[model samples]
Target: MNDKENRSRSRNETSTRTGMGASRPSRRIVAGHTRPCAECGLVDWKLDDSRGEVSCNSCGLVVEENVIDPGAEWTNHANTGVDRSRVGAPITHTLADKGLNTSIAASDLTSGGASRNGISARSRREWRRRRVIDERSKTRQSKIRNRVKAFQYIRDRSQLPSSLKEEACRIYGMLSDEGFVTGRSIAGVTAACTYLVARKEGIPRQIPDLAEKFHVGEKELSRLIRGVSRRFNMHTITLPPQFFPKFVSDLELPPETMMALDGLWNTIEPHTDIWQGKKPMGVAAALIYKAAAEGGTRRTQSDICKVANVSEVTLRGLIKQIDGLLKSIGSPSA
Candidate 1:
């Protein structure tokens, strides 16, 4: 009788300590999974997630305490459900300062903000002066000034997508810091990075177009392409087939034409001896023009040349080489 009374008292004390307010009347099922409790030889364990405790249901003995939770921290989360992420903005390499800048809004110095904060006219003028100095401090160094100039040119002048512009500026920043861009025109280096990034990522931008866009000399940018390739130890030759996807998209080739291009390259790949010294864009333009004609699209050579920025003679020369290759390979389609 005394042991039964003691057990009843223990259960009441444990229930009061847990304090799970109006959760549920039914017991949470935790039987047959864990070893029997030491106090009572029953596997009826009660888990209190609110208090992070596991206890024996019969004897009210705490079997485990302070259990760790792997989920997000519990607060008013269950009441008002929203994912409140505890993190800051992501870092990026597109800026001279790499996204660490904090700008003071000029509107904050307006009459409304001043009245709210009880700020005076003299205080606003003083903060404005401080903001100007802060802005100048970001470009105080010569190298920083150079990076700002190159990145600004990329943002304002280049036709690259926003993601590609980030990649191009990051490359320019790295090369400029490592002296690869030393004694080089800033515009030329920026253009070279943009072109190489486009080519490397299979975007197929023409060097002449990039030079005109970035306001740099074509020959100078081409020379630097070789140097940049050498610096990165990237010795792979850029072939004409790499240009097909972009050129085909520009000409709006059909699905059949895309497939024809695949088979066409397969026949041409075996005859590397013929197409080895050819201009890449010219060859790509000729092949695309031929494939489009075979697929019943019939894109004009002049239009293909204009899209590729290749002269008609260059396109014809590549087509003539393709003719000879087809003759030697005995391709019935050609």
Candidate 2:
């Protein structure tokens, strides 16, 4: 009986191993699943990359087809061995048409160029008229016409860099589509979006600056900003540190002042009462003036006020607040 038991155990162990005594099983995972061909029991398959198909090699049964090719495109313009390539600029929201339209070239309609193309005077006149109609047709609709005008206003008046302008235009477009801009001033919407984007991006500009540039009322701009922020579910909190870099760059303060300015903020941030109710721009301007003085690269209050767009009286109050905070904390006043 013991001999029979030992023989049964040996048979079980042999069955657990594959034909070659390998521990792994013959089945393999394919496309996150295991599927055996109906005609052939073997799992062997071939992938035809050019044809975008996967077929069982044993039975010629197709398992998958029309697979997308995931590969980079090489321009190969010069036909050289190198894989040099170029791509067009990305679509931008700042343009009403997303900058994808092809305009008829005015140069092609000129005298010398028109003659080179073998065009007669009669044809040239007709082509010129067609060009005008084509250009007008792009913005012929009310939506497109309004967008063209609004986007151009943003580009010209926002004074933001190309990136910020793009973001502002994108937000404005979204609001316009959702009927948020209906019965609302375009300049006000553009200004609000600009300020919100700048603050979110960490280089905030005051609402007054944006309003003045866009010729929108300050109260209306503020209200629009709040409405847009709520609609988009975006939280925008402006910190004094976020305004430091821009003020420092504009005033041309030394890099040493940066460390001092940061130190001052770290000292005040923990004291909620001191900073909680203060305006960010006012606090930032005060810190800049103080830091510059401490660093021996002094800038007057007038200079800081001009750059920060804060009145001297407001700046003085912020300066006093910062001084009191530093004194209480036993930190050196900067």
Candidate 3:
């Protein structure tokens, strides 16, 4: 039988045994079918056939019947089980007991739902829906624009490189097959693909020029260029402008000291039969210093003696004669 019939029969049996007119069913009679009361064992009950409610007549507990509860799906629920029916009037009575207005919804008086948390669940759900809709709209618009742009690029294949042109032709074929004729710009597509292939082939092409020709942003063109360059293992040298001048200068000689004296000279004249025996060649270094002062060449006689590999006295005698010879030539001794 349905639950109502069974409950009615059970109430009748209880009233007959007690010899009372009251139709209250005990807890044991409706073990699995009815909900429990913590204060007493089904103290008093009223089952409404019209409304289908199991109510307590003693404490005025009126529970709605046939309500599916969330907790019942679990294997175990302590006290607050899912099968427990949601009652009417008890909520009103409870609020009344607390001297509160019973007409309002349970959420309204509870801190406007803000004192409990940041925001109400209803508002949060509405916000989430709006956000989802906005995101979806934006995504759809972006996709449509990109597709149009790509289509336009494919139509103008003649101006692009062979590889890029072929790709554009292929894309155009695809678009035709897909039944899309007036989507994007062919000129724009041709330039983009041409620039990309140039970068891939290690040829540097400026984006602004391409942008002017194809009606695309220079920034966008640059991004595409870098992407293609990286994919094709091509690298561009970015040396500073000043580095070239410095490199060329390094290869040229220093004209100021192009021929500087670097070796040492030592007089080692030995004894010879046809000449005087070996004698330590010596000269006053002061005389060589004085001769350099007279020559006015900014070089001291000591410097001359060093170059000639001779003593100071020999250097002075040679300097006097060299000075006269230089005068004969109308030039100062250097």
Which candidate ranks first by TM-score, i.e. highest?
2
Identify the runs in model 1 with alpha carbons over 4 angstroms from their true place: 1-85, 105-129, 156-163
- In model 2, what lDDT does residue 172 have? 89
Q: At residue 328, give the lDDT of candidate 1.
A: 74
Give the clashing residue pairs of candidate 1, or none.
none
> Candidate 1 residues 169-199, lDDT tens each?
9888889879887788899888878878877
Candidate 3 weakest ten by summed lDDT:
260-269
Please give the distance, in angstroms, between residue 32's alpha carbon in candidate 3 and its true position after superposition. Answer: 84
What's the best-to-worst order under lDDT? Answer: 2, 1, 3
Cα distance off (Å), candidate 2, residue 212: 2.7
lDDT of 2 at 270: 89
How many clashes does each candidate structure show, in the order listed?
A: 0, 0, 6
By the TM-score metric, which is better: model 1 or model 3?
1
lDDT of 3 by residue, 163-243 (tens): 554554444344434544345444444455566554444442445556876777776656655543454444554311212
User: Where does candidate 2 stray beyond 4 Å?
Assistant: 1-70, 74-90, 106-125, 159-164
Candidate 2 local lDDT, residue 227: 89
